[model samples]
Target: MSPCTFDGALPRALEQIRGAFAGIDFAEVRFIRDMNGRVHLVLPDSADQAEVVAARPHLADALGAYSPGSETGLVRLSDTFFGAALMDEPFLVQDINGTLIRLIERRVVGQDWALAPGTEAGASVAHPPRVSFFSLKGGVGRSTALFLWGRELAAQGKRVLLLDLDLEAPGLGAQLLPDDARPEFGVVDWLAEDLVGSPMAEAMLVERMLVARSPLADSGYLYVAPATGKRTAQHPAGFIAKLARAYLDNDRGGGEDFAVRVRRLLGTLERDLEPDLVLIDSRAGLHETAAAAILHLDADVLLFATDQPTVWEGYRYLLAQLAQMAHIHPAGDDDWRLRLKMVYARASEKQGALEGFRSRAYELWLDGLYDEQPAGGAEDAFSFAETDDAAPHYPLQILNDPRFEQFNPLEHLSTVGAAAIASSFGPFMAALDERVLGNEDLKAVDHAD
Candidate 1:
């Protein structure tokens, strides 16, 4: 059916389509800026108006953005952003299936969500929800954080999959796959062979992942998808124009037919892996690879920061650049801000700074609230900048213990679990571990007798 949202003015609604698909990829985007402006965007290899409209609600829901009706993709907003007259429409197409297939997800209304800043009154608290630890800055300890947190969850018996999306820099492989252990194939190899759809598959792929013995080893399962680290050495002349080249290309880096290949990989993981939680330690930083992961990957984001001011500053700076890539927000019932679990490392030595920060943060927030509402109850408090005015801005669980200082909490947090991790990262990680992994349904993946 023609998008249910359209009123039969296909030519009229084209200009506004560009803004809606700002993050989507297209081959040729030519705009006719005339009386009847048309936004003609040629898809990479696959997509069509049907796919875009069908997936609009799903995309909106997944991104936690402004939700639209089923035919949302058909509606567009004027570039002017002038309140009302800015709505336009455009058509979408698919030359190939993007890594993320747009689908309609049904949500019930029995529960409602509200997103309000400062009030902190609305929103749901989702713990143990999947988070892909990512960094715009590589070597920022994304994998390490993923492993530690996974171990924390595994210890609680919550099934977890440490899905490795770092196709190029495969850290988990080095961490899990031992030098002596040999396997005939890896995820990249299997993917290249398109072995996933087969019914009679041999040896489970997750089982094949290199496992590092940890007190938190999850019986739940942690699979590592090893990237080939394979860079196509050469691009054939006019590969894009060659229809035959489509299936053969896997690298999406301006050359390979990445969308199809990636979708296959994601599909395999989603179905075959069958994990309760998937923690993707994404490829370091903001590349096309990372963009795809961020926009399409189904998980909240856990951004890491070291206690070092430089680390925090660098990350904060890069966050602005990343903002343009996707709808970034922390997970929460009503507010997305909560979904962003900020991990401040080396909190032990930074106690003074942390205290100062919280104190200032509280005061600042109070002031802002007061500004927004002159009669606001927090007027006397001075907002987040002053601790006195803040609503107990969650304490900076200092990871003060020297064991954690060295970045090795396993020894300190072993069987003792919670108490051990708290020694370094403050009570933060341990508390998070408890909050996410200690649900009634979870019984300790690693601690299971």
Candidate 2:
């Protein structure tokens, strides 16, 4: 008999339960994962109590010490307060070997990271549209692209607000704002203060000290809400302590998670700045907090990548997690997945590079985000062909240029002149303009307050 462990518990229980219940018509079987990552079985009310009793010895042998405190290694759904209504809840399907099992996850942390945000289809949004620049790995020029675009928009006399959400490895403050121009407080300060119910964490404070105007945008307003501010720099010792508290949910304020808090923060900034566009710089890779920027912000997510094996492998993990989202929340008239787009950053000038990248992206999307279309081809199915230019897998290409290498808009503005910037980022900027500014449909989506 195998000793009880987190990974072994599920298969063992499933085998034993199936062996006992053979041809029984059980309504449902739920395997709940506790905080400790232990598996707990919840049999439906339809399960015969007598059969359960008779199978107790066999179940015990399978479950061992991790039997969820049950002698029989199972609990009837009817025994809990959740009762019959629990059956109505949408439980995620988990594949164990070849068998499918319904799973109810009870997590102490990272729940928001796992679950996708709920979006209202075709809802009218009155506020300015938000766009998030994300990459699986750093040094992909995600932030540089955001800065250039925001500056471009500002040059065209449009107000642009850039928020730095890469809290752990904060650079936007130093990148955008000079030492003298750095804001008194920034996003991290607000989050930490708000967590403690500090009076300083008010909307007025965000408007006054959390935002700083950058010299990069000379024509129009270019506001930045960096990850850290001057105060953090001055008190470097306390920065980590504040950062540790920043990601925590506001339990006292009715359980507002990290995503909700960020949303509120964005709303407050929007209300104050009234920017024409909001560009967010998300933390690189699959950091838990990246979920807030990607899914929760209702932003048009541009997944930045290069044609590299490591990039695809990292994306596979992310897309697999997102695939779960695609399954659990069925697509509506306007699918939320449609908001996701690919950005082939630092793309090679080689003839086959773009095609190769697109092919790999299409395969990843098909395996993950894209819906399964029928052979007959339903008109409204979310799936797309490989050649479809409008598909999420179809990347907006940003070519490899030495001029933009180690780029800093503030410092290397002369090296990457207008012509160089245009040549390198022209296609990407044009597409982004059309998507964010020209697309009235995208701007009109409904978002909750």
Winner by lDDT: 2
Candidate 1 lDDT: 0.41
**Which residue segments of model 1 deviate by more than 4 Å?**
1-128, 136-140, 180-220, 228-264, 322-336, 356-422, 434-440, 444-449
Model 2 TM:
0.88
Instruction: Please give, for residues 82-110, the per-residue lDDT of candidate 1 as tens digits.
Output: 32322122211211222222111121210
Q: Summarize candidate 2's per-residue lDDT along 84-112 as a digit string, tens digits.
A: 77776545555567687766667664455
Q: Native-vs-model 2 lDDT?
A: 0.80
Q: Per-prediction TM-score, please?
A: 0.49, 0.88
User: What Cα-based lDDT does every candidate model obtain?
Assistant: 0.41, 0.80
Clashes of each: 56, 3
Identify the runs in model 2 with alpha carbons over 4 angstroms from their true place.
Answer: 1-17, 22-28, 53-73, 81-91, 95-100, 119-126, 203-207, 328-333, 439-449
